[model samples]
Target: MPTILTVPGYQNSGPGHWQSLWEASLGGVKRVEMSSWEHPVKAAWVEALDEAIADCQEPPILVGHSLGCLAIVHWAEGHDREIRGALLAAPSDVERPDALAVLRPFGPIPRLRLAFPAIVAASSDDPFLSPARARILAADWGARFVDLGPCGHLNQASGHGPWPRGEALLSDLR
Candidate 1:
């Protein structure tokens, strides 16, 4: 079985977050730790993801949220290593003013097709990226898009704790 690499967004996923819950329950889930979660430097994050993938014994399933999704896309821009699939949820719009203040380094979102199978789950009312933009991004990345209605960022406050629906979505990746 392939390992599942959990990549959290800016500031990291808290204990009540779904990613954290999934890690606790899932057998082969490991987080791709960033050097600085508060101040994400694109190069550093991309390098960290690269190293994690390089260390994997087999191609891993990448589960990324928010800025983590951008990091995976950025990592895929350069690395061509084979992977099982990617499950991206609530991807943030780094180019937006609010996000740009922190995620400006990850700008120029890669509009290229992903090298592996991918599924993008997006919230309709997410303050970061509009649902339409999320759909466009999914199309650009050649990923299957799932519209999660009115779920704000799909974080804890969005009432997504232990989101079993998302777990099912991850299972669909294969």
Candidate 2:
């Protein structure tokens, strides 16, 4: 069975975050611990993900939110890991000046085809990234895109504390 690695964005996924709830519900799900959650450095975050992928005995299926999704994409740009697939949610647009201030040294926008299958899920009204931008990113990475209607970043604040539908989507990959 493939290991499910949950990666959280800026400040990490707290108890209220859906990623935490999903991790609790799923078997063999683990969080890729970052060195610092409050102030995320791209290189450090990518290194942590690399180490986590290396430590896994089985192929990994990544489930990432917010900046975590960006980290996954950054890592995938050059890595050739045994990744079964990826479920990227709510990728914040670090390209914008306001967002870039937080995500210093943002990884290069990946144009290469990812080695594994991937899904990029975004909300229609996500404050971070627009649905069109998410679709474009998915296309650039050669992954499928799913536009979840008005699901604000799909986080606790967005009213998805226990997202059963998101879990069902993940099941399809398995």
Candidate 3:
């Protein structure tokens, strides 16, 4: 089985969050910890991800949420390491004027195509990103876009506990 690297966003997914829950319940899943989760630095976040990928014994599938999704995009721009795929859920648009100031560093999302197959799962009602932008992102990255209607952010606050559907999506990339 391919290793699954879970990358959390912003303040980090809580214990009740799907990402955290999946980590505990699933096998061969690693949480890529960020030292600056509260005050994320784009370069640092990418570096931590790089280390995790580099250390993996086999090519791992990346699973990211919100700003973590952006970090994965940024990391893909400069790295050529092989990976199974990516499942980017609710990718935050750091370029938005109302976005958190700390997240602006990850702005200007890369438009280049990714080397691996991937999927961008987004919500229609997510406050962090619009459906149009999410579609555009998936297109730019050459990944399939999945719009799940009005689910907010796909996080704990949006009440996505366990998120069995997400496992199905990940299974496709696997």
Candidate 4:
């Protein structure tokens, strides 16, 4: 089985979130621990992510949500580690200043194509990032894009208690 590294967004995924649930249920699933969950520094996050990947015995598949997706992109932009793929869900727009003040620093997201394979799954009703922008991001990264209609943020509040489709997507990457 492929190592599934879950990279959670700002404030971190809570107990009820899909990422957390996957960690509990799946084997070889690990959560990337950021230095600070409530207060995120882009450099810190990127470094932490690198450390997490290094800890893995094999190249691990990255599963990022919201800001975590941006972290994976930034990490990939600088490093060329051999991994399975990335599953980017509800990628939050750090460029947008309206949401949270902490998310502003990770702005000016990298548009470079990822070295490894990746799949971007976005929701139509995600307030963090618009569907159009998500598609563009996927295109820029040269990853397959999936439009999941009206699933807000694809998080705990979005009601994805057990995201089976996301699991299937991860399986494809594996």
Estimated TM-score per prediction? 0.97, 0.95, 0.98, 0.97
The candidate maximizing lDDT is 3
Off by over 4 Å in 2: none
For model 2, how does the per-residue alpha-carbon lDDT over 141-161 read when each residue is reduced to its tens digit? Answer: 888888889889788888888
Clashing pairs in 3: none
- For candidate 3, lDDT tens digit of each residue in 38-120? 99998999999999999999999999999999999999999999999999999999988899888998988899999999999
- Using TM-score as the yardstick, the better of models 2 and 4 is 4
Model 1 RMSD vs true structure: 0.9
**Residue 59's lDDT in candidate 4:** 89
Clashing pairs in 4: none
Pairs of residues at least 3 apart in sequence or in different chains that clash in candidate 2:
none
Error of 1 at 125 (Å): 0.3
The residue ranges of model 1 lying beyond 4 angstroms of the native Cα positions read none
Residue 109, model 1: Cα distance from true site in angstroms: 0.5
Indicate the worst ten consecutive residues by lDDT in candidate 4.
93-102
RMSD of each: 0.9, 1.3, 0.6, 0.9
lDDT of 1 by residue, 61-142 (tens): 9999999999999999998989899999999898876766778879989999998999999988999999999999999999
The local distance difference test score of each candidate is: 0.92, 0.85, 0.94, 0.92
